[model samples]
Target: MDADLLKTFLAVIRQGSFVGAAEQVGRTQSAVSQQIQRLEGLVGGPLLVRTSRAIRLTVAGERFVEYAQRLVDLADEAKRAVHGLAVQRTLRVGIVEDLAGFALAEILRRLHDEAPSLQLEIHSASTRELLPLLGFRYDVVIGMKPLASRGGVELSRLSLCWLGEWQGGPVPLALHPDGCGMRQAAIQALDAAGIDWRAAIVADGILPNIAIVRAGLAVTVLADALCPADLPRSQGLPALQPLSLRLFAHEEADRQATETLGRIISETLGAAVC
Candidate 1:
């Protein structure tokens, strides 16, 4: 089987649409469709069910997911065994939006400084979305969550703070779209305190949220390390619980390789908290 075709199949599963998968894999949408068709033809059955709203794996695809990962992992390991850590390999990483925006550059820089031939493919989403992508789609994830049942190394405790100018009307909020842990935390805290608030802006990624807060259009929750020094931390808003920055590795990921990457990421981001 063509490894590229398998990669395309996995991308479609993770991305949920031909368009999204194409963007991720650097192919045209029609090319992605053709690749999927080729893969299905080779497999002798349909692998995915395309709905109007979302894509789902067929039973075959569901069963194939694990095998696909093993094949990819084995290929990566074989190459690295011959060429060492400096071998060119792509590391699939998922990170919550805030950490991606705030510290991803430094982390990547450190990784490259240590291992120049390593390449990274990063997916930035909320913790809700990122967690599910682990073990199958992504090799590792950095999230803001308590170090509870899920085993991961806690990099630091980030103080959650509100950033914006004081407003007279219903507290204007700039937040991520639904399912973000940070957005949920802010909303829950406001609701518990009986404070009226409205989402003045909803941003899918980190920069736009920060821009909204900087423009004074709305208040947004951010980690103290993430908040710009120029932005004033708003008072009179409900207090927010701190977030634990953690690094979670996929069960099937190359542990030795990922541990090295994780340590680099932690060291880079943890210094900000210090």
Candidate 2:
């Protein structure tokens, strides 16, 4: 019945765990668990089955999800209408540098065409640096899902490919600095395959690494979507696991605006991968 409780319930569902939901809602895990318990009590049944691996909705919870979302949306709409709050005019978006190429251009073009009056601010960084700023500094963030964590709506799962030509002897690699999920995957795969590699260039963002690859100085790991057509995918290398692209919207962000951006991003990236 309470909109806040419903919102928290949705956060848990979206985030896939109480800990992730707490991070998304800016609450402690204990508080999130308590809120879920209160919501379950109000609904007169258990809503979730929690396990160490995942959180699954009960049949009652599955049936209630749509109504809960509707109630929360109506509540937000009612508050805005009653209070005469101005529609949100600015959207701050953060994206990983890897996706800042054609994918970003298409996404921005669509967003502007649909919401012409809305102002936009964009930041490009590595996934490691973008996630932390999701709620506090940006209204929405598009980044790679961390290997160990679960949260955010998935936009696409892209196969990781080795880009650029591979010359002989001690494989040269241009990688993003420490914290990058792709870099970690590349290193682990190489080590596991017993291949010798040298970090020819260590950069903070994707552009420099891309440049290195372009110059044929080193090979880099990137999503298949972001790999340049001219830069060939290496024939012999350890296959890396697919990386998931995810969208994170701040819990307190303007619902309409965030949803619009999220939809455009999903459609744009989803189509690109397909």
Candidate 3:
């Protein structure tokens, strides 16, 4: 069995469509369909039942999933064993600014402990800025969900909270510049509630927004875990929805390394909330 075909098959399972799998695998939809056909031929049976709405795996496909994953994992492990020491593989990671604080610290610490040989290049930006670079500049991206339409694994969901002192008038908000998920959420929530708001400080990153909030200039929305203990969660404002943290990986990225990083991030954030 070809490992590449197995990988494509796994991507199809994960993405739930041939078009999505094609994007992940850097192949055309027709190519992905042909790969699946070829794989089915090799396995001597049909693996997937494709309908107009979704793809369903056959019993044979269900049975093949485990072995296929194991074979791919072993292949990846073998490659790492052969070239890890001699070739310093660089893993480029992109993350939202909100997690660039303690959550990121813990993630990096665990990643270093687990995959010490990996050379990492980390970029922290707004989710809007990071998603476009997923397969191009970044091997993996940790971003806020509902922003991406498809193709990311959910890591955790953090409740959004209003952080800072409430001044009691049209709410003064220190929000990120446009293209931020939180910013969009905040504005929509405020508008839907008929609450008047003024963007007191429009910054590109979280730190600047935090600085403004700390100075008592404006209130901002943040994940409950990211809010400072000293900052009060203002009441009487409309409740905000929880933001889902998601991990997106390039199809050709080192699978084990990306999975390890995703697990560490999920655990670190989960522990923080707990």
Candidate 4:
């Protein structure tokens, strides 16, 4: 169908007069009338019945009007698609606090340059929390695989290790609450060796654990992917077998190529943390 005819018909309906629609569309009243006439002829039915005092749509007109509105909306969306291809509007991203050590800052920086208009909402939580929320909560999430979740798949995997202040005595350990994979791995290692240790502190967030470790408060086991640059490390093999944590991304409609995002994360981990 001719979009101009649809436009003219819609304008006439909205403005309530051909003369008014002509003005609204920047066309002569006769041109508007011609467009309407062409549209009525195509439909093979009367679209409108007009009187000097009033104008209104027929049953056919109302149905066609609905379709006309959809066509106009599609046209507008087509225009927006060009701009959207260049930059997404807002990307909702969520990651567990642990993975933030390596991948968090990297993806954020690349998104800034490649999609400047994108509004990133970063949510940090546990792997268990982050995984299921990917169904509706976020566009991307980087964290350990959730045990029961079948939604997201791994982007990459890295070894987990126990690191602490070398000078710190007997390595008073700080740990997050139980049920966490990291904590489970650490304790299993300690138990098998029959190692004696003291629990000096417990923190809810990974950042706090990092802070405590950096401040020499206590030692903690963390993913090798997260060794930060600012804190110096002692050169030695981890006491326990290294664990592996897989980074995952949300999978749903319109999942895009994540190479750029992956590279940013890998490079950032390389620079800021080992």
The RMSD of every model to the true structure, in order and in angstroms, is 21.0, 22.5, 20.9, 8.8
Across 1-274, the per-residue lDDT of candidate 3 in tens digits comes to 7899999999999999999999999999999999999999999999999999999999999999999999999999988888866766688999887898647777788888988888889999988899899889999998986534477998887778898888577999998887666887889899999999998999888888888888888999988887667877778888886777889999988888888888988888884442
How do the predictions measure up, each by TM-score?
0.62, 0.64, 0.65, 0.57
Model 2 Cα lDDT, one tens digit per residue, 61-103: 9999999999999999999886653654887889887788748
Tell me how far the alpha carbon of residue 248 in candidate 3 is from the true structure, in angstroms, after superposition: 1.0
Error of 4 at 141 (Å): 2.8
TM-score of 3: 0.65
Models ranked on lDDT: 3, 2, 1, 4
CA lDDT of every candidate:
0.82, 0.85, 0.87, 0.69
Better of 1 and 4 by TM-score: 1
Candidate 4 accuracy as lDDT: 0.69
In the range 16-119, model 1's lDDT, one tens digit per residue, is: 89999999999999999999999899989999999999999999999988888788778878877888745567778888877777777887888888877767
Report RMSD for candidate 4: 8.8
In model 4, which regions exceed 4 Å deviation? 1-90, 112-119, 145-152, 166-170, 234-237, 243-251, 257-274
Candidate 2 overall lDDT versus native: 0.85
**Collision pairs in model 4:** none
Per-residue lDDT, model 3, residue 262, is: 88
Query: What is the Å distance of residue 91 in model 4 from its true position?
Result: 3.9
lDDT of 2 at 40: 93
Indicate which candidate wins on lDDT: 3
